[model samples]
Target chain A: MLSNKKTTNEKEIQKLIEELDNIISKKENILEINLDEKIRKLAELLSSSNSLEEINNCSEAIQRLAVIIFEKTKALKNRSGILYIDPFLMKLAILGSNIEKLSKAFIQSWRPVVGRDVINLFLLKDAMTYWNSITKYSFEAREEKTIENVSKISFLDERGINEEIEEMYNELERRGGKELYDKLIESKNLSEKIFKAVILSFMITYGYVGIIREPLKGKVWVVKKEKTIESKNPESFVIVVK
Target chain B: MEEESTKKLRRAAQLLFFKSHRNPGIKGWELRKALGQDYTKILKKLEEKINELGLTIKIVSDSGELRTLSDPHEVLSNCRFFISINDPLTITDLRTSGWSIDEIAGLTVCIATIISKEGKTTRQELEQILSQKLPKWKATRLLSKYIKAGYLDEKEDYIVLGWRTKSEVDLENIIRYIFS
Candidate 1:
């Protein structure tokens, strides 16, 4: 048991010596270090000659310095501060930094009232929430005639909705999806548009339908992403609030 | 001789990068004195370690306050995430002790309010600010906890960034998120 303990101590001492050697080797680049008091004390305890492997206490000190060094290096790496900002964010950050410096200077000079700022902050947040509740809209107004035009060209074969399934698909499929929206949704808003828009937005938002805006043609079209062989048939969405 | 040179380089790297109890980072002059020559060679080697990782040590000013390069959000975003916006350090300390969750929620808003406005505030200023909001003894104890952990540096009387918080954290990222 005593021999095994000695071996362990020897191994630890050897490890410490190797670590010190590694640090000591880079003399050209390394600046003079202000050694930690504990590290200095440990160095005093260690002999300059060989047979450091025989000393058990050396293991403890070496391990302590190791932990401290590791923590510092880890913190530095974690800073991630040593990075080049990607091009776009860099330009934006330059403007941001200038503004930040100016704002800091202004605040320091002005010595703004804390209480008023706090009150204003609460008021601003409240006002923003109120405005959002009043003004956020789901979809634009489009006439029901657009939907009728789409129904004429497109066929949904699943729910007994299309009378001429293959006929409609074959007819429209020839036009290469161009007439899908160009000839269909060109009409302006007519009556009962709100109800149709609400239903359409609900379907689009819930992934039951998708709208593609093609900038090339300056038109928007709806597409049904049909389920592939691997996909399970989707169930109807029921809104759940808990 | 080659091995000795390598060792010095490694030792210098450790001292330059590590946070000492007394200072945030090593100064450039001290580094120059150690190597008995220009510090650039050592800095170059250090740069080699981080270049591939998309990180470089930035020597802020001539003082050598080293910080890594990153987007504002990436810079100390973790610190911002960890610091609770509503609760004061007092509340956090009390809860750590035997104080109940219910007790923490209702403390005077003075500590957080004063610190936010002043940026770097002293213990006396905090006490005076919260003299009406909470007990003096309670505030002192809370501030002590933060100081001991190096979360807040109590330099003489003024509170500045602690060694642990030298990470350059800011709510600017929050502003960017909100406005963007």
Candidate 2:
């Protein structure tokens, strides 16, 4: 296990070095060209970040800047989301897009979706099956397999996620008014907050990073991502809560 | 007087044993059903003769399968000895003598086999293969111990037999002498 951990750490270090080189090359490209304001600002922010310590500390800030870059790019070219798209819908789209982008950006910018996201997910699932075998041998829990039991985990399609956001907006309209929506729109860190929340959900629940669980246990409850918010009874937050 | 009966019983018992390993926990009725030629009488005779050998059998409730925890290692060892005086010592017999020579032998065989195939081997590759296939911590811990004990030599990603001066150890020789 220690060897495995060491190997994984080595792999991560190698990947980090490669990614730093790629980002450096991009910075050099930006410097060479007469860059737009957005690219110029991004390049300035990326400068002087070569060491692992700086990279680890500034990565979240870099991602935040990337979100701003994305927004600014959209503003320059009046395409789908930034200018007129519903703010809630915009957040949903970015949430989906950022998960894909961050995963891609971390793995080497070349391989999209890691080319086998679902397969990798399934392999992680198989690791759990091995755990089950170990527990079975130990005579831990002799519970019968619940065959034909429909699970409560209903994964929403992209369309469904978008619709859910739209429905949230509709609920806000019914409960409060355009005033609350405008207030939410005014919050500068809204997108960043949403991204952070989404990432937290991914890390804690989705095994997107890797499921870390106790080695030996009879009954275990895995965390999962949820699309609900419990607090803030005001109009703007109603969409997410419902 | 009943030596012929005992021989028939042993033959039937071996058949039943093989069937159990193939399909564990078979019931008496199912065993009878399986024995098509004079099924009932032959099963009864077999059961009576087996009881005479002082081997008790029972049926498990949940699976309704025949279960027996009789001394299989002893039986196998005795059979091998009867077949030939040079049966050598079984791993269990070695284990009962208060040392785990079998485990060390097994590790030696593994190192030899890997070296033969990969030509050269390393500690990392050995750890990876052992951790992936065998019991993770135990195999790696043992491998490291073997390395420390001069049973294995590491070279990058290749592993080879350490101080043992065997120019060529075939797989059969590995299994028979090293692992046995």
Candidate 3:
């Protein structure tokens, strides 16, 4: 992964350096040309380019292409929701951004989606599906939480989880079925809340307790059920007075 | 069964098992790191040798990714319905709160894209597409949820299918569900 990063970084650096040189060398190259003319010229280059690789090879054109595409996409973003993208523009973004190609075709041939402001959103989907697999597994896979790792949970084992739930039940019993929306979470952290809620849910599903919340009042009545006999700690429980 | 082939099979299994557990799958270059550049051959050899270990390796045609397969029949049989009712209920809960569409759609998009491209794409790219297509906030919300739910995985720069879907549902059934 680190090595791939270096190679990619090198490529991106090379592309950026080339782009920077083009922008810096004013006398040798006409860097201060009109923006519209530049866009049209780049668009023509893209339209005429035989392959995506060939398009990519022209780093200056790809960089200039990104500016126009970025402007267009940004303008489109103001609308409520429409993920339209020109395939060539997307390819320009991909090439310009220096994303690794997943396709076997040495050059992805993108025909222009002409006469349309928004193209099929699927093109973006395709690009994402291809590039994310490479980026994720290669870069972020180790950090991603998985069942095997998240489920490792040594400090919060089954018995420990059950004990935590039992404590909640005890508090509910003392409060005589506490009011509705009792934040099941004792801690501020959302993970802690979710964990506690999950354990409490198990206790409820096992039939030891039941909660009835009023639809309008948003108040809950905790009722001790018949399965109280299974409790390791038996207490005088209050049934919700409906 | 701990011969040289078995050892390699186990190592490959340890490597690829959790990865193929979902809808979008892992690409070859990504796996090449741990398994080495010649991991493709190793995967093929393991594929030929791993029936006894209760796993199978498959190559995703579009993305050219390697994924592990578990018998759906055995998985269904082993699932204790009485204890695991939360599995479906959780989906229900997510649905009630509007997380399921993102989960289901994200899963569907990745599957469709994988089939469409015959190649893998980065999660950032998927998110980029989604950010364009859907409401920006909605897309952002869904991407994170999908990743968290294990319905979608973020690979090196790509997003592949995750393990949760691989174990829980049949691929064809899910595709059907998405369409219907």
The TM-scores of all predictions, comma-separated, are: 0.26, 0.19, 0.23
**Candidate 2 residue spans exceeding 4 A from truth:** A1-242, B1-88, B96-102, B105-109, B165-172, B175-180
Query: Which 10 residues in a row give candidate 3 chain B its minimum summed lDDT?
Result: B78-87
Error of 2 at A155 (Å): 66
Give the alpha carbon lDDT tens digit for every residue of A138-176 in model 3: 333455433333335435655565677678777666766
- Clash counts for all predictions: 23, 10, 55
- lDDT of model 2 at residue B115? 34
State each model's C-alpha RMSD to the native.
Answer: 25.3, 29.3, 23.8
- In order, the Cα lDDT scores of the candidates are 0.40, 0.37, 0.44
lDDT tens readout by residue for model 1, A1-242: 66776566466566666655556554322223344654765565465324544555586557656755665565445334422123344334323433233233222221110111223343556556545433234243232424354444334322322333323333334555234433432235522233233334434444544444422122345454333122122223221111
RMSD (CA, angstroms), candidate 2? 29.3
Q: Candidate 1: where are CA atoms >4 Å away? A: A1-242, B1-5, B17-24, B51-118, B122-139, B155-158, B162-171, B174-180
TM-score ranking from best to worst? Answer: 1, 3, 2
lDDT, candidate 1, B1-180, per-residue tens: 788778777866555545321224444455556664545565667567655654444443322133332323233222111111121123234334443432221111222222243335666665554344346665655555445444455443366544333332233332232124
lDDT of 3 at B134: 59
Measured against the true chain A, the candidates' chain A TM-scores are 0.20, 0.17, 0.29
Q: Which stretches of candidate 3 lie over 4 Å from their true place?
A: A1-242, B1-103, B177-180
Q: Which candidate leads in TM-score?
A: 1
DockQ of each: 0.02, 0.01, 0.02
